[model samples]
Target: MVSSPSATPASALSAHAITAHMGPCAILHDIHLALAPGRWTSIVGPNGAGKSTLLRVLAGLQSCTGSVQLLGRALADWPRRERARTLSWLGQNESAADDLTVYDVAMLGRLPHQAWLAPPSSADHAAVEQALRATQAWDWRTRALGQLSGGERQRVLLARALAVQAQVLLMDEPLANLDPPHQADWLLLVRELVARGHTVVSVLHEVSFALQADDVAVLAAGRLRHHGSTQDAASHRALEQVFDQRIAITQAAGMWLALPRLERPAAPAPSAAAPVSA
Candidate 1:
């Protein structure tokens, strides 16, 4: 069933006419979005479509024009530590200190709540353990970041974000290195987070996976093309259009599936009367 904003608390994040530019290029232009608490929203588009830029702006990591409110207050008004406690961000290609163990990296999420010079508290330990287990990275907690495979490291990064237990989570290309099974696990984890009253906004390349979100926002050429429930007909049309009409959405096994167009093999050309000219 499509989740409605009425069912959630006031929006966790809101943006209006938000514009961001880098040098002479405008990465995001006049965008508006509202993320309800306990909902999952996916922003999707082709490459250079500004999906990542928008996430960064929403996370307050980039400078942008227009209004951005978090928890009903201007985002800029929040202190850094307070904002960190409210917003957890996972960038497209996150880097970790290679020497740090997975456990140490995940524990870093507690920095906003911890006293300076103090070690991790019991609550912090519990949160870290739960996050690790939730992301299925508990077994690799002792491994150094440089030792894990790409997919394993990605899971550990997700564990770190979850360990924050923030009200709003922003993730970009979160499924980059994950296999199908792990992708499914990630979806389940997102749903669990929303069920627990956390708000999630992710820039996802997988249209099928994005379609599973409570809401979908399609961007094209740095402009929002559609923003609404996944079940909306307009959302599907926008999804198809943004992908250059190569993707078709259909129902199978009671689930929405994105099917890509396959090119037909060309028939062999008839051979000219070999050597007829000779």
Candidate 2:
């Protein structure tokens, strides 16, 4: 049900001096970001680092200071339906009604393009089917949401987002609950989206997975620590620092890998303790 915007040469999404506050605490602070067309950008940071808040702002779900632009136009200027059609969002812990079938839930992605009382059209059906197949969820189309396992449900949600077919996608922890194989599948789907000129921005806790992205943004204490290519030294350092230096980044098989460091054994207590007791 998502509608494509008129072709534009500008970036898919941009945020300038974005700041969000929750009562006495600030969730985001003066953040600036942009997602180029046909590219993948991963937001990586420690827990409570405001990555999720930034995604919410980009999705137009959270109010904040500063401006967000979609396809060169101010985000606030777009009609709700138009904006929804142009930008699709997959939140960190999205849940669907337990009684709804997978097919029915995926069909909701078309809501932005549907008339108030209009039933699903042939195009909608085709889009939903393609999306489900893309995410390998077509086989479970008729299953109730509650019947699926955690990973299965996550795939279904991804299918729902894909069905929107928006030019820009913002996903928060899309790999949540996914097995390694399914996670690989999700990565492939993202690459396909970018190949077709779609822009993607994802917040990921998996440092290794984030390394696969075309670019990475690291956040700390509600501020941007680094925003650049994954190969950039600053990005690597920020990523390492955010993780408390517990992870080591290395190139293996020409691919960047973030491996956790083995804990070092503690040194034996000094023999002087025995003499002190005597």
RMSD of 2: 3.7
Q: Quantify all predictions' global Cα lDDT against the true fold.
A: 0.89, 0.90
* Error at 139, model 1, angstroms: 1.0
- The per-residue C-alpha lDDT of model 2 at residue 7 equals 72
- Model 1: how far residue 145 lies from native, Å: 1.1
TM-score of 1: 0.90
Shift in Å, residue 18, candidate 1: 0.8
Q: Residue 268's C-alpha lDDT in candidate 1?
A: 90
Cα lDDT of model 2 by residue, 1-278, tens digit: 22355676477788999999988899999998877777999999988999999999988899999999988889999999988888999997899999999999999999997999999999899999999999899999999999999999999999999988898899999999999999999999998888887889999999999999999989988999888898877778888888888788888988788999888646688775454563
For 26-128, candidate 1 gives per-residue lDDT tens digits of 9998999888767899999999999999999888888989988987789999999888888999997898898999999999888887988899999899999
Best by lDDT: 2
Give the poorly placed runs of model 2, Cα more than 4 Å off.
1-7, 264-278
